[model samples]
Target: MPPEVIERDYGCGDPSKYLRAGETVLDLGSGTGKICFIAAQVVGPTGRVIGVDMTDEMLKVARTNAPVVAERIGYANVEFRKGRIQDLALDLVKLDEELQVRPITNAALFVQADGVAQKLRLKHPLVGDESVDVVVSNCVLNLVEPKSKRQLFGEIFRVLRKGGRAVISDIVSDEEVPEDLQNDPELWSGCISGALTEEGFLRSFNDAGFYGIQILKRDEKPWQTVEGIEFRSVTVEAFKGKQGPCFERNQAVIYRGPFKAIAATYAGEGNITQGGINMGSVSKVSHRALTEAFDEPLTRAQVMAIVSPFIRRATSTPA
Candidate 1:
């Protein structure tokens, strides 16, 4: 990092350090080009790093110093853009410039601008769909408004190429943030008021069709406490890649159990989910059966692994 970069740098951890060479990285809420510059080295000259932030001053700081960082790193592969992470397809800077050319003064003008913005999103998305190999954010996702959280995660999913992943470090609440705490503007900007519950954070990734969710790190102690709620930092890694169709290939899956014991089976000529499932285990899952059943949407390979033994045994049996 350059001298100016080191001075203005801020983050919970070094998510960029995990990037591989020749990658196309998208740094969400990249504050001052520090992480983007660091990532530039990891991705090498052939790769690219795009930093997206809504703050004009921060964007200016980042863009001005981009050349200095590039010279130091021996590559000019980093670019800064104006955008909200939640709505990556809409480039606010482009919209602003367009508006300046034709300022909206009435309802008709406002409606026309909206139409133009919609066309702009489709034509020159702030971040193109499936264009990025990696998405990394540090203490930023939590700062998104609650109503926009789903959009934010969806944008992450939309930008990532299949098999690409998102590595995020941010604060999470031990419990849901109360309405009063969530309403505090200071806390919201400080990355506290809009924090998701740890479980809720994982569920969001699942909701956005990501899998292999893993927690890379978690702070040992709470960063802050609000109304008896503990908020702490955690680095989460979630991957995107669940493509293709479902086909019955003589596969079966029997969930293993030690929680409680009884047995059930549901296998037939066309419906083979073989073996005895522990019905007694129902009590253990009764509280949240439906919700937990599809928590980690298994991949095709995962399903094959679970039923491989059955397939092997049946193949070797007499016909």
Candidate 2:
């Protein structure tokens, strides 16, 4: 792989520290296998790292790098599968259509020119329910269509073992955005405009049945801004366990010492503040930058600040 591939690529944050050796790890939107390769090293020979990507170009790059990386690291424990974050399944429907084959009566009967069926092991979304030890993502969740974002988190929670963890880094907005901004596909794909407000982000995890969702690290750098809009990157860590929601449960709290937070200025005349419950600074981040400032859940003041505008717009809906 070219050095630029590793250097030029943008992401929310590094999510590898939370991983452990001999543990199965899944990387959502695993672009170019950057996180996957790092994760493969952490898991060692006994463990596995699965990279899931919606873009074929990215998967191609990741798949191409797999063998070389494995050779260099001396471990063939990493694999990449192509699929959307919301639909992590192998997408048999697409595969069948691409190969111009009818649906197979049984999984065993399915076959492709490249043996995609066998390659993907037909496990799809592949982690299997309650089968994975950890799930890591970098700046990919914001790209998912809003309608499927909830299901994405639900799937992550479903795939995790009882005490598994979901560590994510993505761009997030300080407040709800105007409709024109949200509709802009450029902003959407670039990781801006459609970002979940901090409250909504944490709420989505809670709604998906995750416990102990905390922000382990964050940066206050706002990557881009237009007009009055601003964005930042965040690294969020949430666990699947007996504990309750981080924000709702009084005891749940964030551990801020693992990663250092550096303050960066926001654009277009705005100020961001961290909430009482969170351990990092709250700053407006672009969609691409959302994954960088992954800290504790937003504070009550922060939550209200992030949600109130959207609520007003929602209630103002015309009947």
Q: Encode model 1's per-residue lDDT on 18-61: one tens digit a residue.
A: 78999999999998988898889999998999999999889988
Error of 2 at 222 (Å): 1.9
Find the 10 residues in a row with the least total lDDT in model 1. Answer: 264-273
Per-candidate TM equals: 0.77, 0.67
What Cα-based lDDT does every candidate model obtain?
A: 0.80, 0.71
Which candidate has the top score in lDDT? 1
Candidate 2 regions exceeding 4 Å error are 1-4, 90-94, 97-99, 103-125, 242-319
- lDDT for each residue of candidate 2 in 38-136, tens digit (9 for 90 to 100): 888888999999888767777778887788888988879988766667756556445656466644565555543447654553555345677788889
TM-score of 2: 0.67
lDDT for model 1, on a 0 to 1 scale?
A: 0.80
Model 2 gets an lDDT of 0.71
